[model samples]
Target: MIWEIVLFVSILYLINIVLLTIIVFKGPTIGDQVLAIDGITYGSIVLLILFSVYFKEPILTVVAIPLALWVYALDIYVSKYLERGDLGA
Candidate 1:
């Protein structure tokens, strides 16, 4: 039962990623594109975690945490660059 639920949710995340990819490409502004990218990354993390649970592979869950941090760092640097015209790092 739980396995089925995980599979279903993973499928939902996959669909979400596809839609977010379209939004990333067609967004009218950079802010919208960045937001879509963030969404895509988060969805990917969820999928990774789900797959980790479904497959009993702990490494994918480990990978997801650093990926989440990377996404956060990307958000910070992009915001800094947009505001200050430079990453300063």
Candidate 2:
């Protein structure tokens, strides 16, 4: 039963990643591309947590928070760069 749930979740994540990749590649605007990349980052974080549970490895889950924070910082940096043509304020 647990294995079935894990398989289902993994399949869903795979589909989510495929769709996000398409959007990232073909999005009409830069904002849309950035949003798709952010979604992919978030989906990867969820997959990391899911794999940690499936593998019974608590340590693997520990990285998700920091990964999320890094993605958020990247978003901020990109937005700033887009706005001002430089990463520095």
List the global CA lDDT of all models: 0.92, 0.88
The TM-score values for the models, in the order shown, are 0.92, 0.89
Candidate 2, poorest ten consecutive residues by summed lDDT: 80-89
Pairs with steric clashes in candidate 1: none
Tens-place lDDT digits, model 1, residues 61-89: 88887888998898898899989997775
What digit string (tens of lDDT, one per residue) describes model 2 on residues 31-88? 8998998999888888888888888888888999987899899899889988999776
Q: Which stretches of candidate 1 lie over 4 Å from their true place?
A: none
Candidate number achieving the greatest lDDT relative to the actual structure? 1
* TM-score attained by model 1: 0.92
